[model samples]
Target: MANTRPLVAQWSRLGNSSIAACKADIPRPALVSYQTVRHASGKPASKDKDKKKRKTRNTFRQYDLKHAMQFSLIDAMHYIRAFEVGQNPASAKYEMHIRLSTLKNGPVIRNRLRLPHPVKTDFRICVIAPPDSKAAADARAAGAALVGEDDIFEQVKNGVVDFERCICHTDSLQKLNKAGLGRFLGPKGLMPSAKTGTVVKDVGNAVKNMVGGSEYRERMGVIRMAVGQLGFTPDEMQRNITSFMDTLKKDIAQLSDRITKDIHEVVLSSTHGPGLTLNGEFKSANSIPPKELAGPL
Candidate 1:
């Protein structure tokens, strides 16, 4: 086929009048019309997004480390209980905040332990297992709030995360992974995993253990958890506190590559109450030095 000549002439060969006429004929691009009517739900555009939520000073409660008053565990419990008088029993919980002498970049302390007196007894556990298998039967018998294989996966995919804890039998691990329920359960920290000890051979034992247990992990060198409720007696509070301390020490020791872990400070407080500095006698018999564990050194 013969080559076709270009239709338009080069701009350089065009006369000034022709160029002017072409420029006039060329339609000017329309101005971009922004949406002037702002929607009530839309976030307003702002320049300094980072500084929007920033605070110039620390406003939250800051404990005094220099002259901390050491209250005994029982005394601290009593002090917190006093603040709970006539308050909602369900909301009155004794919380323990342990400040570990570890750096933010240091190894984390994470473990699960059965509290002597469970802070809360209503544990809604969900078990992932074959619907007709013995694991499911055992899980149901052990008081699982929800148990099923495909049904559980479907519910999770639909964002129906009604349960607080989740346990899976080893046999269902592949099926669970294939379901791709991580997006739904991962953020809630309810996905069954071997690391969390939720993936187990015995579903019944796992359910039972989690029902009466509590998991604690150090975040920013601080471990915080609700230890007991206001309904717990003084003795129960003491036992729960002691059990937690013992479990924490034991978990650190059980590490394959052991490192010296120190407890910097122990503070006991309750909901709607002041934080009382514990005397740090919980680690009195432990290997940690009392001086370092008592207060800021």
Candidate 2:
């Protein structure tokens, strides 16, 4: 539970450096496990902050596990409930927060969070279809039409769906609040509030809704109930999955065919939750964590 002589020397140099390049390039006080760093067993005994009585006398900083070396960010953010004698100063408490003592306006220096690209859907539904043929476009744009993602865009681009078509039959859109929208919006990286602002009478309105930046929020719940129902058959589950994959593939294809080359891992799960675990898909191991990428906040 101590900054070794070498580490202290290294940190001191970093702390006092005059050159902005190396100093800025370096991030100090990384979350390191005293257990792993300890050459002996005399490190401070581990304590659970949740179980102990805490006062404002301690400091804590949250960190992302992937970027913070060994410990996860949530775990790294924990503070010491009580201090023990002979604890190492650096190891005495949880201090993962980025402390910018000097910079008034500069790059943030801490374990940052990233998100993956959204899972899009293929234009399967008919209502949202574009005016590939005047007949096809006229059929739906004139009246009741079934729509999908692409079709929605097509109609909007060609002037099909509009304010009239967007009129809602149910009051679903109004129910979307900060809490409900955050659930799927955050993880899917989708900028929409699943319930509210989902319906539109016209294609122009749908596109405009997205352009206007509808209700998008970050997810706070890492743990959840289920992405889908538990009892779905594999084929049924696959239909939903392919719908998602089709969208993902289309977005990825927009970049390059060799996109798979950058893949770190590919996991196909029916529903990631308790009791029913359905996993089957051909994927690359190189697939990176979604949060590592920039996403709609």
Q: What lDDT does each candidate get?
A: 0.75, 0.31
TM-score for each predicted model, relative to the true structure: 0.70, 0.22
lDDT of 2 by residue, 51-99 (tens): 4756543222223333322322111111111122234322222111111
Give the clashing pairs for model 1.
none
Among all candidates shown, the one with the greatest lDDT: 1
Off by more than 4 A, model 1: 1-66, 256-258, 281-297
